[model samples]
Target: MIYILYAVLYGLHIAIPFSIRTEWTVLIVIALLRAVLKLGEQRTNHYIAFTLLAIIRDRVFQALRRLCPTKLEGRDKGDLISLITSDVELLEVFYVHTISPICIAFLVELIMVIFIGSYYWSLGLLALAAFVCVGVILPVIISKRSGNLGDELRADNGELATYMLESIRGLDETIQYGGGEKRLQNLTKKTIELSEKQSRLNKLTGVNLALANTFILFFDIAMLALSSVLYSRGDIGFDGLLIPLVALMSSFGPVTALANLGTTLQATVASGARVLAVIDEEPEIEDITGKKEIDFSGASLENVTFSYGGDTVLNNLSLTFPENKIIGIVGRSGCGKSILLKLLMRFWRANTGKVSVSDVSVEEINTANLCDMESYMTQETQLFKDTIAGNIRIGRLDASQEEIEDACKKASIHDFIMTLPKGYETKVGELGETLSGGERQRIGLARAFLHDAPFMLLDEPTSNLDSLNEAVILRSLKEEAQDKTVILVSHRISTVRIADEVIGMDEGRVS
Candidate 1:
């Protein structure tokens, strides 16, 4: 449209020299209109891009939630973070720039060809051919030559991100072991490799752009030459010679945008594929929905068999725990103590037999209800960067201050918390780095206490606590055992000594 107006104004300047004032007024109006259209286009494009990005982000988060713990086990945390952050963000290229411009280029090229062809059939054909080459053919060729470079670049980027995060998280260990220099060297090597891959991609992008420019230049020269020949033969006039030449030269804008997208689109496609892979991953255990909620009475594993990757973790395990009993599970490490608890929690499906609660198969129980009825605490408690009170309240979001404190007392950490500078308000640094291991364990106990579920699964709950703290926590567990079924998993005989019954395990067998 801008080129058409420019052509008409140029012709007027030459054909009607006295109409310069009118031509100037028309030129200013066209310029202002073009500015308004450009602004509108930008506004619309950004609106679409931002809205799509938000939806994609939400979808990615939902996917993560679905894949977590089980499907995401052993997955690289940093790679997942990169996918959710940068990979998802890269999609803006496709939504904002690629989609709209491709459509606009085709439409504009069609209109330009028909309009130019009305003046001269040969010129219109030339424009059509040029548009195909620049808009379609060139991108296809460039994309093919790029040859999985985008995927390789994305994979390298993920690896680098993972390595960087690992180095940062393990910085203290690296320093203590006098391996800081080695860690730094490893990081530098990874960084340089990533940079080299990116440089290669950038070089390909530069070459692709050069080829597009060459195509535009070739078409421009060809169109002008053709128009000049028609003008000299009296087949057309000077206006005809200049108008199509200017329009064809300027009309490459839309197609040129597409040509530029070819290189970037590869990365976007790779990112989109990774994002989709996460969203499409099948969960290890399909959640049972639309099932009746069962009241917690007792749980039993009947000849349950399970494996991880092919090695048996639990085999022919049969055990029963009556309601409201403190049943201690004692086993050596790798003897399926924690695995039994996970099976009952339905984190994994048993390969054979049944893990049932209230005489109902866990898979047949509503997942939300099952989660609400059981509170499982692991040896390593995870604490977020939040206030002490906030972390404790995670067990029960609506727990009152008194309830939180009471739970903390039961966990044998209330006095310690009160002595802190900010009491319950003190912020625990990332992964509870600001607190001691025993303190973190007490916080986990507090969470379990605050939850007050019908069943509690404690895996090495007192591992980090000193003798005095362990005794206090164990006493609290015993006191709570009257109302809740407690499955206490511990290697320490002293911790399990308080339980009403004890089950020993060895090499995936219960005794």
Candidate 2:
């Protein structure tokens, strides 16, 4: 409008030969004001986008926390990574650029129509049709043609990520088995499939852009031709003919933005669906909260029936462990030794039976209290890429350096750590891959030891250790047995030799 005014005022000066200094001053002021408002609009839009992204990310992480260990089993790590990172990021475009752009396009065209109508009503209707075609009708058609492509694209991307992650994690195995070529071929196949899906979506984007520009060009020519005819007819003044034509030409900016949104929002639509799925999902087992804290005593399970969907893993299982005792549970592979420990931890609810802790049902205990009372160690200890001290501190976040060293000494890892150049300050690998299996296992034991809970669940704690280190760790367990009740689970006879009473199992029952 300011440019239109400038054109009008300059035209008047050319015709009337009068000083138009005041009109020029007013136009300059309005132009500067519009620039300031535009800058503010950009900042505000992005501020809203980033703020919303943060809230969404927080909700996604909370949802994952509620679904973890149990519900997350067998889920591809790559899919979760893609959903949390790229998927969440793509939504920024929708918030910052999509919603308001559609509204602005509509309003800008509407106002342009009105301004053109003041010149002639027919010209106003023509402008409306042109705007609708390029902004609304064309984009809607393109989106319909690209129906569900967004979902497929996101899903395929996740699959490729999962495959790549698997390949990388199992690279050692692949090389050992000479399966590297096979894995590479599979990787290539997945990459090609993902690329094909992306290519199809890109083709649609190209078509939409090309057609949008063509429609815009055609509209400009149509408006110019019609206005010239009207000028010859003298139904509208020279100002109406020229000014309305310029307005129509320049006003496609907002509509063009709408046209681009249809193409860019493809990934965002799929991303939004994936993100919302996590947030909206109900956890299989909700965390127990707001209960009175319970002191650790003895723990047991009776008549428990559980399955991993199809076949029963633990059926009609029963066991008991007394306080201040090192009780051993032994079973062959495919038996329920690990699952039994997990149930006691309340990672999974038994289909039909009571898993009790401190003579109270675990389901009735406060999660925080249970965590405080029990230090559960899994077979493979997960460590983040951090200093060795940092990893060990995870067992007790507030544990002191002295406590950490003491715990590591108990696990027979302190001597090895001291031999390192940085000692406890040395950084480990992502997933602790930089360390030997024995080192990682000992670190996990150090964590459990540092926790110093009354009830300890150690699964294959010394599986990676030599006889000397194993004896040292077992002796440490015996020393702690005076203050802690330990469930020492392993198939190794040496591991169970330290137990006060060893329980033997054939299936899920005490045999």
Candidate 3:
């Protein structure tokens, strides 16, 4: 449709030699229609592209969520955040701008070749040969020369994004550790390197454009020479010669548009490859296909063994937890205490042995069903920048207002909240920075209390609190564990004493 309209429009433009012979009204109408068509094409293209981009973004986020779940121990939050937002958004160039136009341009070029052939076979052959030389061959050679650089630029951009996020998040730590100067110097070098890569990309694009422009100019001159020879031969009339030559000249706009595609699509294709890399990544563990739900009142791990890379984290570990009991896992730092909790959560599958909840192997329990029965709170509590009530609702979204308040009170945080002017409705700034360490820990405990799951795992829940706060939190846990299984991890022997049973670990093994 774009071709038919364009060809007729170009033919009419050439037919009216006198400026006044072209009816002003008809030209205006054509201009308006053309504008409308272009607008519709762009709008429709963007609408479909953006919609698909939204799906891609969702899938990228889903992959990240699966890769770094709530129980992820050491991954950087800010780095993951950068990947989801900026890195994913950069990919819109590929879907929206590049693919549609590239397809449209090729279709238009094919139509032009057919139109030329209908006029004169020799002329048609010349145009076809020129199109293949400039459009096909030149682009392939240029892209081959520059494609690796484009890929390198994109990889550098991803790394730059990661670095920026890391620097921002660790600004305070950097300053405290007296490493701010060194880190900033490193970032400055990275920024300069990124700029250099960008400069190289720009130079490549310039070279491609310059080459395409030069080829187009040469093709037009050659076509003009051929047209003049045909006119002199008397085989082609002057009017016929004039019309197609003018049309060809006008048609160069579309050809140039097509040639420019190599420059336009480079960034988008590079970004697309980056996105595909993440989507194609296989997870460390495959989900069970037809796992059954199990009643997990009690659980145990028998000779469980696991490793990350060549270093074993848990070697022949064995433990059993009875129903309605609170177990404390205590050990020196870097022991497999946290690794055990991760295995129980199935965040990492054990290489050998079995983990079961009430004699039903955890691997055979549906993931969603297992999530419904267990709640694990890591050492670092991540609170969104939302109202206090909103953060607590993450534990059990449907909990009534009264239930929330009761949980808060049990966690010994209700009084602190009441002290604030807005109380439960008060906003906790990013990561709950507005509140103290004690407050964040209490909020975490409140979440566990509100969730009221059959199994609860708390890693260093009271590590950030004072004696008074810790005692109050321990008392709250005692009350909440009445009919539930609780696993507590801490270095404080005093904190460990509160559990119904204590398990000590050393060097990735039970001691």
Preferred candidate (lDDT higher): 1 or 3: 1
Candidate 2 stretches greater than 4 Å from native = 1-19, 192-197, 430-432
Q: For residues 1-511, write the lDDT of model 2, one tens digit per residue.
A: 6354555757766332234676666668878987997899899989999999999999999999999877788887878888899889889889889987887788878999998888899999999999999888887787778887877877787787778778888888999999989888988988898889889988988888899989988998999899999989998777767777888888999998888777656667878988999999888888999888889989998899888888788879878889999999898887888988889888888999999998899999988899899999998999888899999999999999999999999999999999988889988863356688998999999999999999999999988899999999999999999989999999889999999999987767777
Q: Model 3 over residues 280-381: C-alpha lDDT tens digits?
A: 776665556567566777989999988878988888888998888999999888778887888888888898999987888888888877777888887877
Ranking by lDDT: 1, 2, 3
lDDT of each: 0.87, 0.87, 0.76
Which stretches of candidate 1 lie above 4 Å from their native place? 1-28, 430-432
Measured on C-alpha atoms, candidate 2 has an lDDT of: 0.87
Q: List the residue pairs that clash in candidate 3.
A: none
TM match of model 1 to true structure: 0.94
Lowest-lDDT window of 10 residues in candidate 1? 11-20
TM-score of each: 0.94, 0.94, 0.87
